[model samples]
Target chain A: MPQRIVSQRIVSLVAGLLFGVGLILSGMTDPAKVLAFLDVAGRWDPTLALVMASAIPVAAVGFALARRRGAPLLGGSLRIPTRRDIDARLIGGSLLFGVGWGLAGLCPGPALVTAAFGIAPALVFTVAMLAGMFTFNLLFEAGSRPRGVAKGSGTSC
Target chain B: MELAAFLPALAGGALIGLSAALLVLATGRVAGISGITGSLLGPPDDDTGWRLAFLTGLLLAPLAVVALTGRIPPVTIAAPTGLLALAGFLVGLGTRIGSGCTSGHGVCGIARLSPRSLVATGLFMASAAATVYVIRHVIGA
Candidate 1:
């Protein structure tokens, strides 16, 4: 079990390192670049699309392989989300995320990733993201679970 | 096909997927960022050490890269800080309401082929696209 814990930490670290490096290399860490792509009327930059398109296949294949195994390398069975119906929350969140992405061109991942670059704005985004997460928790108490129950519960369908 | 640009995302995504798999293999935990972040705020004795370390590494990894690379690219925002903060707040609220973020739904959840994750991911992507359209063209922000 200890071995597994260490391995999980290592994997998480590696994943984060790669993600940060990818953000830097793909220029996703740069809000100006992302905004430029969204600037369809002016100097439209399609760079972000290429990154997304490439990432889609990689993500798809990874998920496919992991699914086939029925378990992850570290240890636990993959806990897939079971809810299917869309609601106002989903719509609202997506719209809000997009607006933030459009306005700042810094989503959560890249915003966190780019903080290493020492960008003032990335710091702002990261702080706001954390604040947002905290605020959500306070208002809805979303993840509050019974003391001994598992994190996801697997009960809600 | 801009090999330089494509290679990075491909490598990065693959690494992220692999890391998620590794974490699951090693610790039996979902690589859900929201869940990890949430744990930070709860009871201190709830085994949050690893989660804190993981998040810390996430923030520091880029810094390490910048140190080695000499200089990192600059970040620019099209909107004010207040607007960005509001947007972040909304995203957090959405994640709580929806039960997960992109990492949970889009990456790990979808990989498991859960119907709920599929719906959530679809909603997230669609909303994101629509928001972009409105902001850039409709609202002109």
Candidate 2:
């Protein structure tokens, strides 16, 4: 069990490292690049679209392989989101997230990576993002489980 | 677009996919950045160490890049600080409430073919496009 825990941590560290590298190479960490991708009506840039298109299949294959094994190589059971019900929270929350993505091309991963450099914009944004997340917990999820870690939900950030 | 640009997108994206796959395959945990980071702000759990390990990796990526490539990529944020702050808050709150972010929903969830992720991705993509239209084209900001 102890060995399994160590392996999990190592895998996670490598995952994050690779993920950050991917973000930079894909331009997800670059606000200008992301904004250009989002500005569909403007002089749009389609490069980032290619990024997503290529990433999905790779991830899908990974999930399939893991599922086939009946368990992850490490220790934990799968904690992926399984809720089939599409509630108001999904719609409204997604829209809100989209608006925020539009406003600042920094999503959680890219934003955290950027903020690590001590850049003021990324820092401020990071702080506020944390605040917003904490506020939500206080409001709707105070006594509940970690909203993101609830049984069926996936993990990010 | 130039081949120079195209290759990076393809390569970078493939790397991301590989990263997600590796995490899921190794740990049985979906690699959603928002959820990983967001959960940490709350109470500690047995799941906490790996989460921190992952983030440390994220923060260390540039160094790894520099080691491998002999140079670090640049990050540019054009939005004003206040606007960025608001956007950050919304992302933080929205991702938690919604249960994922671009990586979680856009990449991993879609990969899983989760219905909720499909709808969330579509809705967010449309909303984001619309918001950009309003900001850039409509208001000309």
Name the top TM-score candidate. Answer: 2
Which ten contiguous residues of candidate 1 chain A have the minimum total lDDT? A148-157
Clashing pairs in 1: A73-B25, A74-B24, A74-B25, A74-B26, A75-B24, A75-B25, A75-B26, A76-B28, A83-B116
Write down the RMSD of candidate 1 (Cα, Å). 3.7
lDDT: worst 10-residue window of model 1 chain B: B38-47
TM-score of every model versus the real structure: 0.79, 0.95
* Residue A112 error, candidate 2, Å: 0.6
Model 1 whole-model lDDT (C-alpha atoms): 0.62
lDDT of 2 by residue, B35-121 (tens): 888878877787789999999999998777778888657678888988998999998988888888889989999999998888888
Give me the candidate number with maximum lDDT: 2
Q: How do the residues B24-46 of candidate 1 rate in per-residue lDDT, one tens digit apiece?
A: 54444556666566546545533
Q: DockQ winner among the candidates?
A: 2
**Cα shift from native, residue B20, model 1 (Å):** 3.0
Off by over 4 Å in 2: A145-150, A153-157
* Predicted candidate 1 versus true structure: per-residue lDDT over A1-157, tens digit per residue: 4786676667667665665565566667777787776666666667666554554455555656656777776674664344566667655655565555666667666777765556676677777877877776566555566422454532211
Estimate, for each residue in A1-157, the C-alpha lDDT of model 2 and write its tens digit.
5888988999999999999899888878788888889999889998998888989999999999999997888766876666888888888888999999899888888898888766779899899998988886677656666443566643441
